[model samples]
Target: MQDTYLHHNHQEKHLKSSELLTDIVIGMSDGLTVPFALAAGLSGAVSNTSLIVVAGIAEIAAGSIAMGLGGYLAGKTEQDHYNSELKIEYDEIETKTEVEKEEVRIFFREWGFSKELQDKAVEEICKDKDRWVEFMMKHELGLDKPDPKRASKSAFNIGLSYVMGGLIPLSPYFFVANSEDALKVSVGVTLICLFVFGYFKSKMTGVNPVIGGLKVMMIGAAAAAAAFAIAKVIDGK
Candidate 1:
């Protein structure tokens, strides 16, 4: 029994990792695509090295804050929903203890429990309020309590990943920012990064990474083209 319990807990640790991995892919993908788009657009508009540097800096700062806030809000919203559901469950158990007991018995019945055994299980589990609530949440609502700290950490991870991803496209511009040469380099780097990022996400999600990557690459290219076209028209005046 000790070995089984230990193994179960050990397995749970691995499951928790899935959440962070998902956050990483999402964060890094944002970091790469967005800044790349911004850099490409600005690079087209002006060939000034100082201007590019300023734009890159601005994007890094603004984008990080924006991504972080978005992630934080999303996590908080999910947490709030879970808390509300939990409250409702608690209230149900509080006001209708007998009804809750019957529900638990029925649930275990489906698991092939005899009425005698089910009764004992229900009685023992309901003895603790915390344990009872947690059990109901898992069995009935299929949810868990949201940890504010975990959510906040996930948000931070996402933002940090975006910054890391965004750096890929921005790096080349500084090294070759003197002439229009840098813009092309940035575009080249951005497309490659987009494909790699897409592949990683696809692998995780079981999607076609090649197609996903190409689609992402096309989006970047289109954004850059539109920006360049606009700049050309503006310059014509």
Candidate 2:
């Protein structure tokens, strides 16, 4: 019994960790791609590295704030939805007691409980209002109460990850003198980072790591290429 409880606890921790990883991937992927593409595009139009670095920094700042706010809103929505459902469940348990009891019995019955066993289980479950509401929330609605701190945590995590990822591609522009030369280095560095990021992301999510890596690398490269092409064409006019 103790072993089973410990195993369940471990699974919960793993799931929470995975959620955090997902936030990082979201922020990091966009952070790397956007700044890299912007730098590439500017390089095609302008010769100065300073301008590209300034633009890249500005984009990173704006992008991180937007992404963090988005994460926060999403987290808040999840919590709000859960709370709404929980309130409904509580109200139903009070106003439609027999109906709720029957629902609980049906669950036990489906679990292969004998008639007497089902009665016993249902009685045990519905004895306390709080426990009964919790049971209904978990078994019927399939919602675990979200952490109250999830919104703020997600915001911080995603914003920090974005800043970190954005800096990688922009770092070359800071050190290199020419925009074109800096872009070359940024391309090499950012694409490598994209592939490595995708590889680990896929591995965690149980996908093919090599293919995922290539896919992410290609996407970043294509975006940068397209942006550079557009800038060059416009500059020529």
* Residue pairs clashing, model 1: 31-162, 31-165, 31-166, 32-165
Candidate 1 off by > 4 Å: 1-17, 109-121
Can you tell me which runs of candidate 2 are displaced by over 4 Å?
A: 1-17
Model 2, 16-133: lDDT tens digits are 3466887899999999999999999999999999999889999999999999999999999999999999999999999999999999999999999999999999999989999999
lDDT of 1 by residue, 12-83 (tens): 322233767877877887787777767766765677866877787788888888888888888888898888
Ten-residue stretch with the least lDDT total in model 1? 11-20
Measured on C-alpha atoms, candidate 2 has an lDDT of 0.93
